[model samples]
Target chain A: MSDLKNLRGKAACVGAATTGCGEAPGRNSTELMAEAVIHALADANIPLHEVDGVFAATAVHSMAAMSLAEYLGVHPKYSSGSNIGGSSFLAHALDAAMALEAGLIDVAVIAYGSNQRTAGGFKSISEPMPFEAQYEPRNPITAYALATSRYMHDFGATRDQIAEVAVAARAWAGLNPEAFTRDPLTVEEVLAARMISDPLGKLDCCLVTDGAAAVVMTRAERAKDGPQKPVYLLGAAMAHDHRMISEMPDLTATSAADGGPRAFAMAGYGPNDMDTVQLYDAFTINTILFLEDLGFCAKGEGKDFVGGGRIAPGGALPVNTNGGGLSCVHPGMYGLFVMIEAIRQARGTCGDRQVDGAKLCLAHGNGGVLSSQVTTIWGTEETL
Target chain B: MSGYFDGPGPEAEFRQFLADGKFMIQRSKGSGIHVFHPRVMVPCSGETDLEWVEASGEGTVYAATCTRRRPEKGGDYNVSLIDLAEGPRMMARVVGIEPDQVMVGMKVRARIDDLNGAPAILFEPA
Candidate 1:
């Protein structure tokens, strides 16, 4: 398994693309997937015929791997769908890296697209396994609220502190032209927003939008020859601690405890080494938890860590520069968007939201009500 | 391996006990540890023959949350993680308090409530 860590620098994410975001009423999931793939291939300047490997988050439409393979008409070797929720795509990226290392396939495409808002909004994960169906926590919102409540009770964090996350998210979103809701949101506005769950207000949750995003990963050598300056994959790791929220070892922690160290250690850096970070923001609670567990700060100091202008643009650490799922497009699972933003940042292509001369960036994904975590460290080729 | 094994097994027996207004958790015959969500085997020791023990129905709230997504069924509902005295934990709702009022480490006792046409376990402040 340690030898697999040597797969480090062998592959790089060469292209990233997002399309059909916001309220696109006409396009369905399939069309959005195809459009994103076309744009991503165009970004890479690689023909559709060169692709062999594919991984997709098929939560929007079930067996989207085979369906996407058939749609694109480029079937070669490998295909997989391990939908562990939003982090599914990063798991796909991690698995695709392993597959590419094993000499199984080349040019992997991890894609996701959904019409959540146009379709009247997302349907929470309802599928249960065995005893889960018989005995279950009926709502995902309630589950997340329980986590926030526990975080507050345990760490003495306050609602306003958590609301600071939303305020920062909108600040970044203000710079993004394509973000769904870019209106400046004050901490007061976030606190004043209607409460959906006990602690999480409407703003604390992500935007429901129609969107598609895809990433193309190929050999680092080939990436050098590609059109876009390749963003080398420095390190990547994925892990899930619990399937059920009740079964999580600790309420305030997540798989980031295990995944963060593995990803950063392989890349030979620490949280302090990251130029900017893009931790998943399915809820504001997630940002705080990820910041703490990923070693940005000590366990319970996340509220203070993000209290000042720390995570906002032009701050010491700019996060979710594309505004993230909070103000950007959260078309169901958002792992793919995380990749797109990381790659663009590494390439220094983000015009306005770009972190000035960001040499290295960390893109993390959280899935299934914080069930799984996948972290990928992407850096400019200069670092490689 | 240990105490009484009723003919119905864990899952069926768990549902049956809910109808009887009783709460039970699986105790490993080998390790004598309690496991929750009704299963046939012990997690750590792989002890197959588990015994059912009636819980004191008394526990403490590990965490609690209020959700308001589904308005048609009901606007909001509170779900909580309750840590039982029997050295196990379970997920259910606590009654007799507003969802916002429930706090971590609050002592609660188990009670049965009708949900979706069947008796389901719930916790109330002790």
Candidate 2:
């Protein structure tokens, strides 16, 4: 088997794009996805016939790769429809990188779309676990609330500290014109929002929006011919610990703890080397937990590490520069959008929210109830 | 046909046991390792040498959250993960107190309760 560490910088993202988000009244998931795929291909200055690998995962379709391929009118030589929940897109990036490294396919297109917001709110994409379903926890929100309770209990982290994550995400969103909820948000407002579940109010949850995104990738050598500067995939790792939240070994920690080091090691860099970070913040507590698990701080120290605008725009670390799923467009699975934001930041294309001279950045995706984690390191041409 | 393979699956057997007013759990006959959700095989070893046994019904709250509901919609209820004394953790609710009052590390005891006209296991203060 090929070593994952050896796959570093084997593939680079040449093009990325997102369709109109928040509300596409009449557009179906596949329609939105095809639009994104077309736009991303155009951005790469590549035609549809150049894409030989199709990778996708969605809440709407079981055979997402096949569906996306059929919709785009291409017969791909390689395809993957593995769905590990919200992190499915990041997993696709890792899979695509491996395929590109092995010369299995020349060009790969990873795409995703969701109409959950207009389809009448988010539905549980994962099948209900026999044991966990009986308790009637409100799908993912309750699962996350349980984690919040345990995290707060173990570390004495207050609700105010947890609310800071949402506040920071909103602050970032205010700078992104494409963000869904860009109005200024406060910690107190988050605390006082209607309780979805104890310890997590409404503001702690991510926005329910309709959107689609696609990214085109190729071997690092071929990526140079693309229209936009290629963002190289320095390192990538994906992992999962459990399906049901109750079965998760540690509620306060996620699979990121396991994958983060492996990814960083593969890239020959650590958390400190990142100019910015993009995390799939489905809930406020997600930011706190992932920051800690990704080695930004000690296990219980995430609560304090994010306080006083540490992760906000003007803070030491610029996180969720595209506003994140918390305040940005979260159309069910948010993994792809995070990667797109990181890619934009690495390209130094983000206007108001861009991190100064961003070169090396980390984008992490979380799926299920912190079940699946894919940590990817993206860097600019200068880093190579 | 031989009767060696004739029975309800692990899930059905578990629900039937609950209906019989008995709280039960599964264990690996070889290693005595416990598992929850009544799976067919051992999670660690993937061995099929599993057997059921009566549980002590004693557990401790590992984590909890109170799900909010409107007043006419039965108000609120506490959903919790209880670490059973038998070494497996399971998801259930702790009752006999206010929903928000349920705290992590609190002792609890499992009991058979009716939910949606179906028998289920729930927990209460020990």
Q: Indicate the residue-level lDDT of A231 in model 1.
A: 86
True lDDT of residue A367, candidate 1: 88
What lDDT would each prediction earn against the true structure? 0.83, 0.91
Clashes of each: 0, 0
TM-score against truth, every candidate: 0.95, 0.97
Misplaced by over 4 Å in model 2 are B1-6
**Deviation of model 1 at B123, angstroms:** 1.4
lDDT of 2 by residue, A1-384 (tens): 756569788899999999968888878899999999999999999999888999999898989999999988898989999999989888899899989888889999999988888888886556778787777888789999999999999999999999999999999999999999999999989989999999899999999999999999999999988789899999989889898988999899898999999999888889999999999999999999999999999999999998999999999999898999999899999999999999999998999998999999999999988899999999988876
The all-Cα superposition gives candidate 2 an RMSD in Å to the true structure of: 1.5
User: Across residues A256-364, which tens digit of lDDT does each residue of candidate 1 receive?
Assistant: 9898899987787788988879888888899999999899888999988887878998788888888888988788888888878888888888888988888898999
